[model samples]
Target chain A: MTAALPDTKVLSPGNPPLSPARIVVLGQDTPFRLDSGVELGGFRIAYQTYGTLNADRTNAVLVCHALTGDHYVAEKHPVTGKPGWWNLMVGPGKPIDTDRYFVICSNVIGSCMGSEGPKELNLVTGKPWALDFPVITIADMVRAQRLLVEYLGVDQLFCVIGGSMGGMQVLQWAVSYPDKVYCCLPIATAARHSAQNIAFHEVGRQAIMADPEWCGGDYLNKGTKPTKGLSVARMAAHITYLSEAALHRKFGRNLQDRKAVTFGFDADFQVESYLRHQGISFVERFDANSYLYITRAMDYFDLAADHGGVLANAFQVTGPDGKRTGTPVRFCLVSFSSDWLFPTSESRAVVHALNSVAANVSFVEITTDKGHDAFLLDEPEFYQVVRGFVDGNAERRGLAARVG
Target chain B: MAGHETNGHIRPDLERIVEWVQPGARVLDVGCGDGELLHALVRRKQVDGRGLELSMDGVRCSVGHGLPVIQGDADTDLKDYPSDGFDYVILSQTLQATRRPREVLEHLVRIGRYAIISLPNFGYWRVRMELLLRGRMPVTDRLGHQWYETPNIHFCTIRDFITLCDDAGISIERSVILGAGERPLPHPAASARANWLGEQGLFLLRRN
Candidate 1:
């Protein structure tokens, strides 16, 4: 790392966070064309499941993972060996309640961690796809997921839920396959990527490209790795996931294991060391090329632009003034007050769009100092909202509890 | 009447508003507080209900009980809804809390086929007596806050509201002014006694 970035180790983690037990290739029957107009003959989708599908198969809940997330929603992470990222919300007797409904979470097509992405080897050339991988968007990721869900013989998903980029996928699922999704929860997300967000992603992308070891996205072929670049990119992106208040509350310019500053190119601050560990650990389970591709995918997400500049039209309704046939899907949008990355206003815009059609929708902005990561952490109000919404939707769908 | 509770159980203000909502009607309740009225209407009439509350506590409570509630301001968020969008747009005891009660009232009638609004009367005998006798802002069960920190702005008398309806071309389908026990008074809103006797006014209106 340069003097600008903190450094650490990456070659220690075992299993690399890729669970080989659940991998399925889709698009075998026909070619799959993406939003970028690129066609893929076939690709793999890595996934994990919880609970059991009812006899009618209408009890499936599809959980979409965010940019760095994988299919491990309620299980042990194969990478960090820590608990699943969403364990607080999606476990037995929890908000999502594995005891009741069948839940499926998949790594998006554009990401790594066993998913078919830029880091994977091309079947034709037998080399890592790297930059050669076809550019995929959020809709493309949902399309691949739709194929996988179809392959599983499920006609409708009971609920589609996620946060951040996962939330974007959730919106895409509701819009793309309207009939397939019965309910959706898009949390801490926007209908379109903001310019400021795109700028942050651009910085991360440029850092990886600037690294000499990146080698034009062919580091794997040359028996080299872009560890420094990927770590730096992770370091930069991680800061945006939090707020200034959260940063101050966490580190607050506290010195790191010393009385005073060493005045050298070392981590003199606790925050720097914490970020260093975060960046260092992230690179071990992630691929640099995959980071480039996923950030690009997020930068291109604009649900309104695809539907003639009216965000409401994207949800099968015209503008707020238009006559409404109403959407079949019930939606619950959520946001955190401290999340500057995807602020409460973005979620409200989606809520207003839904309200325009008088669609069945609910929205709540939970007050917290924890920032965007609050969704993954323990927030009682957010938890209660999820539980109530999920259970309420279940009650309306006429799905009875198999137990009790 | 099967899901209905005794009138003595709920607050007097919501009990009257809840009685006006018909079964299976499409409804939007603004400033719904903790959604007590919507909750009662949903349980009793099974109305296809939605609520807009301004406070996070209110939203959390409403949503936790399986109600479709969103956090929104009555003055600003009302414009986003389409005209004739709901069967009934309810603004119960919340009009005075708004910045533009007139524009908000106009939006309510425009968006819904019918609009039901209730407001605490400022020209009530107690308020007049409180000013003439003590020379201080009145604080009663209806107007529960002090003047310094009260959300009750645009406090209007029944006569003032009737004149507002006439000025805005809104047709009042029914107007009920409740007295000390929240009992519906025999005197109508246009009657001279309404300004002196009634504690609050509930109006059912439509666009002219």
Candidate 2:
């Protein structure tokens, strides 16, 4: 392990004990050789597993996380004391019902959580890698995940599932290691990054870079963090994660603290307060440059283009000689009706491609005002769909139903 | 069909069809919304089941429920599925909505050992009464949509379906008229009037 890297987990304050979460950290000794020529060696993946690995290990599910998510898929977050991103759909009795299938969720590479990222120091330089870290892509992220799974001795994953950036990883997993995944649930994602999404990411990048304190991504060493810039960046990206209807329902024309508008930049509106809260809370645990690298990776994701111009080719369910090795990746895509960032149209495009190949694919458009974050929110309908699907998959394998 | 389970133990018509499916039988269902029937077959009947569906929501729900369902328009995409990939092909309540029923039926029979099909009978008394007295499309519980907007592109009676099957050299293995849920009415004529003039036609067919 790099001397500059912390020996233990990223134990943040106010966070609960890791024991309650029971994350079995892997990748501590073997580093993944990245396609970018740089190797992230001695990396440790913090992950938690629910359920038994059935005799064949075919019942394991790989749960990928979105940009800011860590390995805590259904546990409580250590820093903010919040529940894991998809807790509503992934607990003992929940839809993903960890009781029936072995669920493994790890923090992605280039993340601030126990994973290796730019925020960690380089052993040679005795300084945080920061901008010195090699640029990674969504495909690279999936490769790292594959290594983690291989280390765990799981040959074929029953399913790979995630939403938004997590969904991007799910798609890459299916394409890059087709034989490993039996089913894929990529929610609120597109075949490729849209111009609009790219543009929004650009605005956030510019926000981070414009800060004088950013110091060419070396702000951490300078003891002068780019808090303002990163906060603004978070605020902007947060809006894209929500629908107009959700914002209206949550904030609307309501004032923040006082009765009337202060008529200044003092966050007079409730929405402003909410955004600021999101930004401030975000900056407390996240590294600004790590966000830059992860979002850039997402921006560069183009699954169909990588396989071929034909989107249908990505959905091919078989290898040469009609073998199931390269194919048999059943797909389930879910999109929220009000999610403007990655709307139902984006999901439909994926579904259409799967249809062209006559792939075993299913798509669900959850009727919710919660927008892109609906997958993470407390929506019973979304949970029901997920629970039904997960349970259904378990039953198909002749596995006895585990009481959730 | 008559000696099947009684009310409390009354099996869903789809389950009844699945119950008769031989173990390990490869089956494909058209317009399989949410794959409830396919899931049942795969789980209880131990059948290798796959399905084609149009609604993404249905596909998603079915897939989420862990069924092998593909999101595709059955009217045009049926040709893409491999021939003889299934022992039994089914088009339950979805045949009437297809743009070309005859073509789909032809494709279904050509691909499977047998095909199970069910459709709402349009010759039921309510439809006839609506056409004769009201002069408008009947919006009954079985056929719920208004005339111009319904997905039933090719409505047919039990007789029409039988003739098509016979003309295509397909033999009817079992045929029944179900009233309401699973109660069997008489023979072919029962399809014209049941459940106070609402009827459902089910057929188990085989290639001659």
Candidate 3:
């Protein structure tokens, strides 16, 4: 769901100090190559970290951001002046517990935040990359995060955690860098974007492209924002993140502060007003082209297809002799019962794959009417499961106790 | 039965279940409440243990204890696993609660080289006496609940369980009949004596 953002960046009390951090992970020595065969000479990653890395650096937890999320994990968003997207989950005593483990979150390469994306000026042409930025994938986003993790001198992340599109990145991290991840938590995500998933995203993309002010993806250079189209896109996409029950419970056919319907499509219904607000606020921080790129990246994600059509092969590494070895990383997969966006079947598929390989894995389908946004809300059961896994793994890892 | 319990605390009944498991073997604990039995097996045998629990609380607690557990039903989810996927499949005090005990039993033997199961005996003297005298479902310490409140649906005696195993072509490799307080009742076979005397029965079975 489009996070109902509060217009203040003042971090919650007792949070660890953070420096606005940015690093160039892909440069001339190693050009950042796209899956589509284009190579950018240099690209940077903007990241935020909470808590402190222990002397051994084994306590670092990498928190991957979702489709429209940026680096602000537990603090305020620089652009919207709102609380970071995951402030509820990554606080000092929250499920992620920044007091005990170092937490890092970054804007994905194709996002419109501080990171390099369609909004950034191209070094060569000195204009916005826009649609010309060359498409990126989930794997590519993870490759950049690997560099950031290494740049921080962390040999292995204690945990890699995310939900929704971020969950796809978590799964990619486990598959791509088996040794570097001790444990992984991929919640409310699928190994492959389903046909319906792609369809919904396509509708959002179409909304942006249909807007006349979009200037054919050159709106940035033309000094115009496709606010109407982007807002509509956000409004339509927001529905998928919530359940029909939640929508009905929250608004139903309730009128938006009126005695009766105005009868002229001026958001007479509260749901319409809520969605309009979601669309309008989204345009202020996100770019239309970047949304297109990221959604396309999610659509292209099919872990099974990448591994000769066997989902199990994604978690197993092939050695020089063509022998397959299992990964050492433990995994905990969670899905909300009402999350039709990333259904329990998707998590079950991943669990089945892990089971086939005899990989250590845990899974739960939590009952909630909050739908796909359940992970972002105050779900005690979800937190208990995560905290149990994290704390339990910490015990096994012999990681230090919480600072509290 | 209570789980492996709080930090470093282990249950005796779960410990008894652990004794039947081999070191380094793969195990699937079907109704792993808080994963007490599975965790014990993991700690004692270092087995690659996995659990399936119906309650979200149990699943979370099991995972919290560092055991790999999934939330699922025993009746439906058992068929999802490949045949002989684990060395041992455990269904302790959980068979009677299943909607289809016979089908679940068949799945147990098919999915594991050996299936370890424990259930309260319906034919025990106290249960029979309670029914005969009070004309009500027995509320023994093991059973613990009134008829309406209990999850137990397909209550079986020691002899009944053996008969079901025999009908399913499963061989009973080892067996124990426990009275009150986790003590083994002195009974030789799945006879009327064992069925009537034991409060609960634990058995290790293999596919024929």
Candidate 4:
């Protein structure tokens, strides 16, 4: 089944707007099966790699991106005309710098990007898969990425780093392949998605489905899009990403364009205009059906389920020799003070679990007004912490050997 | 006690503070669980290190981690550490929960070059609202444990902490009020809402 799929050469967002790292395709023809029993005759992964792979292949770093991010960790995005989401921290001289480590970022299987997703053609039906794509879990995403890593001829990663949903994948990578990852940094993430977070995602999905043009997630053929619903969904979700103080600072009581309120729902405030822009721009590159499927996948993520109900059991992983492990996958958990969605407490719970397993863990409570979005923005202190860690670790790896 | 070797992995917060220490500095950490900071200083910064901790488990853990630590209570063990042994006796976030902060401060100043202290600010507007309006101990992301289960014994406002530092004759050399990942915090309001708006406070001090 995996062999039937076509080549994936044009997946990179290049030229005009931004030059995002291109997705490198791999895999041979045999129906690649997912955890959900859904199979694809051919498989292609949209991936971007940075730095040079050493002869021994030990200096590779696998970075898993958040739900909305793509394979553009340090490059610019062509459609958005903006720098990569994490450009502030990953570059020639920055932490997680492309020059020192071979970094790989891939679009998840259920995403709207080059990877096979809800919009891909279904072998069973001659049309786009749409909602027919099998429900993929966070673990499934990790497994698919693992196969890609193997295809790249790499067996171990110097570090697995990410934040938010990407952080979840980092944790999965460490636990699922303890021998493969030397250091694990899962920032601003928890062992599992919280109930409140799941609730928020549900609201966004409902808002998208309620649009008159949704047509049950098959709006592509209707020549009409669920613009309003998708916009509202984006607006609501966007609120969760920012703090009240950040909003107040960015677009306080200022009016959209007029001095006084128009006394109508026509975006009277600047925040309204900003939110509308977010909604509109979001719909351009995103598909509403893919949003539904991806959010649902995040909602179902329960790391402890694979290792009984005890979260600690997940950390008590063994090495290849089955002895009590050395290093035991040390972790660093960072959380923002204003991040009401996942919050610092959620990160603490994960830290406690790591501590219970006697794993080396350091937790930081970085103060930020940007709320959950703090992870994406340019926070000097945050970057310093990351820079210190990455630089110190890189030195230990003797990356300096390559420099001189 | 076992002979110890230092691994040089200082806590990020402490890493920032170590740069301010004078040469041949002597330091003590109250509630110094596992002696990571002290061990790092001894190994990398060439400082004399000692720690007073209440938990036997903590002392043992520090011992196992190749750090030299004594299992004793911070509130009662100052006399054993002797005067002038430490040039800078540090209290990082342990000032709040001590049984006698006043006595601890007095003893800390007597035994070291100065006492570097840090704590969360209770006067932050959010804490006030949590107490006044929420009608329950506010469970924020920073202070997540329930009120009854919390380890914080001293709830000093930023103003209170500084005033106490002044009254104790501890001269403040450097202070940093850390806001979450990226928010900017002003120097004047460093103590006032740092507990609520910021995550923690770091200070360098000496006897006036």
The CA lDDT at A33 in model 2 is: 73
Model 3 clash tally?
1
The DockQ-derived docking category for candidate 1 is medium
RMSD of each: 6.7, 5.6, 4.8, 14.7
Of models 3 and 4, which has the larger TM-score?
A: 3
Candidate with maximal lDDT? 3
* Candidate 4 chain A lowest-lDDT run of ten: A4-13
Worst 10 residues of 1 chain B by lDDT: B1-10
Residue-level lDDT of model 4, residues A44-144, one tens digit each, is 56777766676677777888888788777777675676777888767666667666677778888788777878877665677878877788888888888
Pick out the ten consecutive residues of candidate 1 chain A with the lowest summed lDDT.
A1-10
Instruction: By lDDT, rank the candidates, best first.
Output: 3, 1, 2, 4
Q: TM-score of candidate 2 restricted to chain B?
A: 0.87
- Residue A149 lDDT in model 4? 81
Misplaced by over 4 Å in model 4 are: A1-31, A319-327, A401-404, B1-208
True contacts kept of each: 0.62, 0.52, 0.58, 0.00
lDDT of 1 by residue, A123-228 (tens): 9899889899999899999998887776666789999999999999999998888888999899999999999999999998888889899999889998888888
Among incorrect, acceptable, medium and high, the docking class of model 2 is acceptable
Q: How much lDDT does candidate 4 score?
A: 0.72
- DockQ: the better of candidates 1 and 4: 1
Error of 4 at A170 (Å): 0.9
Q: Model 2, which residues run further than 4 Å from truth? A: A1-17, A20-31, A37-44, A48-59, A317-326, A398-404, B1-23, B33-36, B43-45, B52-88, B98-116, B121-153, B157-208
Q: Provide the DockQ value for model 4.
A: 0.03
lDDT of 2 by residue, A1-404 (tens): 22232222222224433544332334457656776777765655556665566666677788998988888776677788887777676656667656667778887778877666788767668898899888889988888788667766689898889989999999888878777887778988887889999999889889999999999999879988888889999999999989888899888899977988777789999899999999999999898898899989988888778766876677665656776322467777788888998988888787666655545666677788887888888777666666666666666556656522
Candidate with better lDDT, 1 vs 4 = 1
* Of candidates 3 and 2, the better by DockQ: 3
User: Candidates ranked by DockQ, best first?
Assistant: 1, 3, 2, 4
